[model samples]
Target chain A: MTTQTANIATTRTGFGAYVLALTVGVALLTVSGMAQATVLHDAAHDQRHAMAFPCH
Target chain B: MSKNLLSSAVFAGLIAGSVAALLQFLFVIPLLLEGELYETGARLHFLSDGMTQSEKGTPGLGGEWDRHIMTVVFNVISYTGYALVLVAAMGFAKAQRGLELSANSGLIWGLCGFIAVQLAPAVGLPPELPGTPAAELAPRQVWWLSTIIATAVGLSLIAFARTGLWQIAGGILILLPHLIGAPHLDTYFGVAPPELSAEFVTQSLGMAAIGWSVMGYFAGYFLSRSED
Candidate 1:
């Protein structure tokens, strides 16, 4: 990784977009990583196991 | 978000998630199938007479067509989510710290992500297998998330900090979650053989490392390409 030191205000991809991406990303993770519904758990059982999420 | 950013993230995620699911299908699922049998009492590792049973039956890819599809779908979605966070992080690293990550360096970024999300947290809560008795789900999830966050923040600080004091603080952050400890049941027990359980954890982590590194390369590739 190299360093460019571009000003945030005039950056290539604005900081707001990165924040937005972060928000949407975390939401998806919450669904896959933390949802507790039985249907959800059953569907994601193998994935939960593979990803090492805590499961019943 | 730029169209380029979104598309790049999606593309990277699709490839990464697919690779992860493939690895699970090939190496991890068979063990899981075997472990599940032990979980359901369909197979017993320890006989009542104290004579250890070596093996009863091979794990099957039974005709659970629907369920299998769901597993595949979830794996893809999960990695896509992970890729979004990763690429956006690289973007943040550039915007805030002036770190420019090219496709090549993305491998290191990916490894850092693996450590923060998998390896570091696993120190406290090792990857669990089917039928392994565990503590309450809620507390374990909380600890897991805390460990991931602390490790991620700590690593970036160490990587970006210019001074020794800041680096030491980063080390402490990485250690904080383990020091507190993962929540666990009072008694240690598992229906699956200890050997089987250990393999599941090792293979899962190994697969994740590869998946993350590939995703990081693509994410960085697209992100840099998008800027051109």
Candidate 2:
């Protein structure tokens, strides 16, 4: 049972899953933090300022 | 495996992001509304024209429900995204270094997050009020991105490296971007008063500190729970 559980744990902590989390997280953050479209900028203006992202 | 990771990110992001949004409503938005007036020429500071009208600071929400709603939405998304990144990194640390993830460890991660994401890059590009002058967008963004990347790598080394040489390399990484310097306008100028600008910087960082810390806490909490 312990070995079975360890296998499960290791599979969940595997490289592929972590990479997916990182890639998606980074993509979302870029949208929220660095997107430059005027509409997106307008929507996120206060947030940009608050996050200290470069803003005009 | 991915399911567990995704669930943890989603739940933690939602709760922590809401907390961050509430804090923004309480502190960040009013000052922002006031600053917007300066941006639009509704209010003027350092009066070059010698006009004598008092600043009409935003004392209320002013019925701009749409804008406020947008602010709340954006705050949630931003903080959630931050949580995802932090939790993913924690997962890596757990796998590679045998580090434990828990609420307490998450707080330290949160501090590191704030330092890497906001505080470090901010040394070159401090938070700007709406009307504050800044360098051209592209260069500033480039500098900002590089600075955060360097700081994150440097911080990881400092936190996890076993050797003095590796840690020293990390130290150099942290300083490298600042040494390169952030792109800035050749001359300093702005439409907002210096005092308001300074307060914005302070309050913005404070709010961010709160946001990142909470996000880190929950990210650790949820990820650990899901793994078990």
Candidate 2 CAPRI grade: medium
Which regions in candidate 2 have their CA more than 4 angstroms from the true location? Answer: A1-12, B49-57
TM-score of each: 0.92, 0.92
Off by over 4 Å in 1: A1-10
Question: Model 1: clashing residue pairs?
Answer: A2-B100
Per-residue lDDT for B163 in model 1?
97
Best by DockQ: 2
Chain A TM-score for model 2, please? 0.74
Give the Å error, residue A1, model 2: 7.4
RMSD after CA superposition, every candidate: 3.9, 2.3
Please write out the lDDT profile of model 2 over residues B1-228, one tens digit for every residue: 566667777777777778777887777777877888888987777576875445645665578778778877877777777777787788888888989888889888888999999899888888988877888889988898888889999999999999999999999999999998999888987777667777888888888888888878887787677655
Worst 10 residues of 1 chain B by lDDT: B52-61
Q: Candidate 1 on B76-114: residue-level lDDT in tens?
A: 788788888888888878877777768988888888999
Clash count, one per candidate: 1, 0
